[model samples]
Target: MTATAAPPTSAPVGALSSRRLLSAIFALLGVVMAVWGSRMPAVQAAAHLGPGQLAVVLLAAAAGMVAGLQMGGRLAHRYGPARLLAGPTIIFGLSLALLGMCRTLTSLCLVAVVFGIGHGLLDVGANSAAVNLERACRRRIMSSLHCAYSLGALAGAGLAALTAWAPYHVLFATVGILTAMAAAAGLPLIQSAAHLDTPAQPDPTQHDDTPQLQPRTVWLLGFLAAACLLGEGAAADWSAVHLHTLHASEATAALAYAAYSAAMVAGRLFGDRLNARFGPTAVARAGAALAATGLGAGLLIGSATAALFGWMALGLGLSTAVPSLISAAGRGGPRAVNAVAATGYLGLLLGPAAIGALASLTTLPAALALPVLLAAVVALSAHRALDSK
Candidate 1:
């Protein structure tokens, strides 16, 4: 006798739910990051740490994130990204909440590691699932998903500011509870076990059941991801400084970062359509070119008002670069994606210091030109990096 199955319409329902669930996952990550960042000063004060000590703690967290990304990629490959998401999601929320209770450096370090692990795992799992979904649907949604993340971060940051008078523990607990609820709500939609039970579709570009990526190609892609992230890091860390260099008032300088962030949100929200119409390589190349042009213009103009426009343009230009590259990395499977993520993270570590070093050697505006050059490299090499050759 044949086994009875649900109606064919069920598949579409499941797919829709899965897509929503992926968006929720990404948003939750953004919320966690913003909440933690806003509450960082409190945590530091509780641990009685100075600026240098706080940097050490942050480095430890970064270390944990790197390790987790390494393991999360391999594990997600073996077990499936959907299945890998659940445990880490829960752990991440719990750790963030627990941060309020850590009164000493040792305890804070331990909790940070735990949170970092969760953060890294969720990052890999969610992005991996996004890639799979895009392949299944055969359209570009990565940019929209990232836009959701940016929106969530904005919302969380706003909430943190509004609730600044509340105790750290209470604020963190609120965020944690919300994250947990989101995870629970999305659990049924993930269908991770179902994915594991079923056979995976073959890659269109590959003949074998397994899609293999070359090591050299993987490294190349990793560097491309890193370059894109380098631009992102520079924008986040130095936008305000660049504005100040143009002799902007303190209040106007403060708006520089906000302008860049707003531009990023706008770019990502609309970028999916661009990706669908133009393709990833074209979109990425254009984005990089625009970023290079904007940053170069800002440096050349040496005016605060012009710099604001330049920063906004830079944000728009770099907005979709990482998403497009990450989606391409997903073609090689979870491990490949992880390699790319890890490499990209190295740029975040280096970005601030690199700018600082260059500033010491030259002028700040001159140092800021490095990201412009990097963007140009991305524009030129995007096709080579994205193709699985």
Candidate 2:
């Protein structure tokens, strides 16, 4: 038989440049989601819905996100990240606008699902692109991309808090406009990245040198990711409420999220260096320890300032785990993506629900501590994984 040509080892020229730009656009979208999503309490108040009714609507959003996560990998593989990124972003913006217009619970639930789908798709596309881009650059870039998301989130939350005095509809409309612009900016990156196309068939002459991953490896990473994500999810869903509980005013309550986002951004910006110096295993373990400690301390101290500090610490600690795990899985090979995505997304999907359930059964403070303990478990397991490897 004739020998087959080997796949190219080098990234196409300009691919890295395009990837950086795409990262920025994805960050912008993340900011919009944070700002608008954090304002849900106000939106519910505007709709005159009780807590029970509002919970159902929010659950719809979570369900939609789960659905998107389940399908995102296949879609990205089939259609490529560019189309997957841009199209869903536009849909996300439209759904944001729809959220502003909805008056009844039914309408809100529908909008929530649409928005979740778009959000989920955007996340998968952006993250996949970020990972691929980093691989091409042969340096640490995922942390920076995640930092962009944190920065965007910080800006969005800041802006949302600042504009709380304005009409709620105006706030959402502005978010929609910003997200649309971000979608437009991302379109070019998708066109230029040719490697995102399906991988060529294997060459018979080439040896398969990729490392083999045991099934336990998948579950281990999944467990760690779930715990790390639980910490993140707690901050995203409850920081503002916690602040409010601490007697902060409506506008200032958002600062809780802002602090967490800022910490996340800062951690991510510096994460590449930290990862380089320490390695992914060390980073994940340390991050979990810091998060668990910070969160537990914050809840125990029971001060607004302490809470903010705790949230920031939690953000910093949790920042690197998800990206690091994703990279590890990808390094393991293609089939690993499904397991990584499914496991990671499962943690992400369950975080809010678990917190909400805990809140219902006991106090929010006690529920918040659940993630701290979970994070501790993640750190211990991650350290073992690293040592074994």
Candidate 3:
């Protein structure tokens, strides 16, 4: 095969350029997701929707995301990652503006579906691209790439907070238009650094979803991913509520998630080096163990302050697991990435609901044990599950 790209240290520089471009995409995606999330309260008020109604809208978007992930995997396999990204990236960008324009439940649901599809497509496409880029550079770049995404999300949330006074429509539309233009400008540079791995011609009759890794490995990796991400889903949905239940003030309750998120960003920022030095299997195992033990103790204690530290421990411990797993999945091929990511995303989608349902049956704190248990399982199983080589 021809050299698709270059290593970071031994580069003619094109691979480095591609890596930077991919980081930008990752960052932009983080910003988009964070901004949308920050404005959910505004959207809910504007559309006059209740909690259940809001759940329905969120579910609609999730359904669309699932569809996009399936399609994106096949497309990335067939088209090469750069080509796979072009359509979805643009769709992702423009769909944001539509989100601003909707005012009714029906309209909002429709827009949410579109937005979710774009988000899902971009998610797989970008990760697939980053994996290939990492391989080209012959280094552990996945964590650093993910760090850009975390930083982007922080930036987006800050932007939304600062612009809280603006109308939702204006805020969404303006950000959407600017990002869409950025997509237009960025696409050509991304496309120029071609990184095709498949043979130029393929047997049309061959099954298209075939992946490079053993089926067992893919599924197990998927399980690890699901387990790790479940903790994240729990933190996003329940940390504040859990704190609120402890009778913490509103401001303090908010800090529970903030601590988690900030610690996650901090962990990811250093993840590449840790992975490079200790290897992915070790990192995953250690991270999972830390999450399980730390968060487990936090739940057992009565103090909200301790809970915040527990979430921080959870965030830091789990921060590198997905990136490490995704990178491993990438070595298995795009179709492997597809299978593993879908399984993981499905877990993320289901995790919060599972916690909520369990909470109804038991106390919320007890239900929170689900993630801790999963993290413990991951800690036990990580080395066997991860394909580090």
* TM-score of each candidate structure, all chains considered together: 0.91, 0.84, 0.93
Question: For model 1, how does the per-residue alpha-carbon lDDT over 309-367 read when each residue is reduced to its tens digit?
Answer: 89888889989999988887876788888998999988876887799889999988988
Kindly report which residue pairs in candidate 2 clash with one another. none
Candidate 1: regions farther than 4 A off? 1-13, 192-200, 203-209
Question: What lDDT does model 2 reach?
Answer: 0.74
Candidate 3 runs further than 4 Å off? 1-9, 196-210
Query: Which scores better on TM-score, 1 or 2?
Result: 1
Best candidate according to lDDT: 3
lDDT (C-alpha, whole model) for all candidates: 0.80, 0.74, 0.83
Most TM-score-accurate candidate: 3
Better of 1 and 2 by lDDT: 1
Candidate 3 clash pair list: none
Task: Report each candidate's C-alpha RMSD, comma-separated, in the order given.
Answer: 4.4, 4.3, 3.4
Worst 10-residue lDDT window for candidate 3 reads 195-204
Where does candidate 1 clash, by residue pair?
A: none
